[model samples]
Target: MPLPGTKSRDAALIAEFRMISGASEKIASSFIKKYKSTEAALDAWYNDPASANGGTSTPNKGQEKKLGEIWEKYKDSSDPKLVKIDGTLAICEELGVDPGSDSVLFCLAADLDSKVTGEWEKEPFVKGLASYPGNIDSLTSLKNYLPALRKKLNTDPTYFKKVYMHTFTLAKGQDFGARTLQLDTALDLWTLFIPPALTSSPSALQRTSDQTPPQFAEEEFDLWIEFMRKKGKAVSKDTWSLLIDFIRSIDKDFKEYDDEGSWPSTIDDFVDFVRTRRSSK
Candidate 1:
């Protein structure tokens, strides 16, 4: 029989949520009581590592390899949604909680990190929801590197990339008519599903991916002199600055490994960086 009292990892969650939210003991206990069912299942899963996919506490070397393993195991899962959401929940559960707010927040971070390349490579952005184009859904969903995108970018670059490209194609300088495309409806159809996610009532920003590091790396961030020539398609000046800022943000993480530099995580961040920087100039 499983251990009594509580599962191993999820036991830690009570503390995590408390720390992040600064919940009072009374509030925390009350919240725990309110969400007892979710907490219990989460803890139980943590107690049994198998409840989380892989059934092992160790991580496979790289994100790419890890993703390959997940695909092999679950591509044929009897329950699809279970594998997708619950699988992710396993991580949050391990982390102490899985708030929908957190999921939506991270997705946004990923887009900003990867420069928002493409949410899906088809119309309507949402993978499976959108008509697949070029036989590829999104970089985030690509077969080989799913885990890598999640690990490295803290977001799914492939999936977001695919949807981003599709959104761009659809919105390429094309203005929407009054009340043409409902904001939430648009995000619902996209790979990332932003509006309903970011705001309780949706924002008007629509779809926009523009980060910078990837471009600099793509262009080798070759001294400021060459930044202009290569940056047109790869990045913009404001994006370049933001990349510089972000690099500073994680200087500690990348410093020990290599003094070179870490890149931004999304296409959206990059695009804005360039535009903002240029406009400022």
Candidate 2:
């Protein structure tokens, strides 16, 4: 009744779904049957973004299952504080997110769309977190699932801005600055978030060599100095992150400024705005 290799293919899909959802084989099979193909089914799950429907809704059943699994594991724990705090750390560790102090709490609140009930105080924020059950672990799973959405969206330049904007928002303006993000974590964000955002546009392709210069010349440090001189500012490794965020914003506003059919198509554009033929206004 099934096509050649259909059994193996179906088994593979079941395994992948189980890994992502922690669902039983029956649940995974039921989940996978809704799509014409495994890939299409995965796409539907990932493309659904966060919302306010609480447990009844999410981008996909897999995400809902992840939250359910985490809750089922820890919901009845005797130590609420331990589950609340250490459980967050466990989720962050799995997601490769920073968990210094209670940073995970803030991240969870932001990701879960919890209301900002207090004036930037953790106490009030934590108290208001009641709206989001599964709290820390739920947010972690949501963020963990976002990259799949991001990867799918990256194919369309329009969604590139969405990826970083969503990331920065979830970070709550605290994802940068001195000792804020480790080098490896920063690199991961850059790899996942930067390259897609910086992709040059079709309009930029026709530009001449003189119009677009490299961001780095013989010496990388010298190029950095040139960049500072143009902006009349200096940056340490920590501060450089702020600049990166600024660039992300610029990309969001302009939607591929590189596509403007002009210069400044490369990182070198930031080196000297004046020489890059960009309007200094």
Candidate 3:
């Protein structure tokens, strides 16, 4: 089960993710209900972080029957889209907001993942992973079901993955400004959250040129003044978002990364180290 104080927060996070990503609350609530119920079987997911396969390839009709009943009732509801609860677990693992944290955002992450998958955008989270707060090993893998409900996504995402590799890159940001990412990245100035799959390894944003990507580099106090002189927007939301993500990247994962015993005990530490390197360099 999620930690004691986390249930309501889960609701809120899912709600926020829903609003931002265009999901509905009713559907989020159902997911939480299922996640919390048979948690023991699934909770280990957090500690292990490697079992995020979306659907059981082999027959598991016993569990499927139980999950299908819920899917059948709510799947058709117009209030919100819902996948079979089991189908969602793998995606939830990748998204990382324990089904029980601030619901407002989980809903959004859920919807966002679904929409990204439905539209056949590069589904980064499909095989990504994250550490849950209380999980023993602090990691979980994520994947998608083979056949998705949305007809648009009937085609495999293998193509979308190629598009991501083909399109987004060092030059695009320079030519387009940060706005090129408006649709592709889930940037929120408010919560300082980014999809863990995409957000990890802040250093990964380094420019193809010797110079660092302007966004990942901390804006020195001097640059702030210069931008002010140039009448640049002092608080462009993206800048604010980058700033918040910087802080959160440190705050959430710093301990695991910077410790001199410093060897990464697990995957989280390795990812955290990537974030710290981005902030410092």
Per-residue accuracy of model 3 over 78-194 as CA lDDT, tens digit each: 424454344455435554535443222332233234332212112222211111111111112111211111111111122222222222332133344543333223223122222
Which residues of candidate 3, in runs, are more than 4 Å off? 1-45, 49-59, 77-113, 116-281
Kindly provide the TM-score of model 2 when superposed on the true structure, using C-alpha atoms. 0.40
Residue-level lDDT of model 2, residues 1-281, one tens digit each, is 89999889888997886565343466557557767565555444434322222233323445445555554454325553224444555555666776543223333444344332111223333332323322223655346443443344433233443433444444334444433334344334444444442343211111223323223222433333445455543223434333443343332123334434333323435534433433443
| TM agreement with the true structure for every prediction | 0.21, 0.40, 0.24
Model 1: C-alpha RMSD to truth? 17.0
Cα RMSD, each candidate: 17.0, 10.7, 16.5
Give Cα-based local distance difference scores for all models.
0.33, 0.41, 0.32
Worst 10 residues of 2 by lDDT: 200-209
Question: Alpha-carbon error at 87 in model 3, in Å?
Answer: 16
Model 2 has an lDDT value of 0.41
lDDT of 2 at 117: 13
Tell me the TM-score of model 3.
Answer: 0.24
Write the residue-wise lDDT of candidate 1 on 1-281 in tens digits.
65576544334555553443333344434444545543343333223333233234433345335434443343225553223344444433533433443332233223323222222111122222111111222233332222222222222233434433334333322343322333332233332332222231111121233322222221223223243334434332233333334332322123222323344433343444445556687
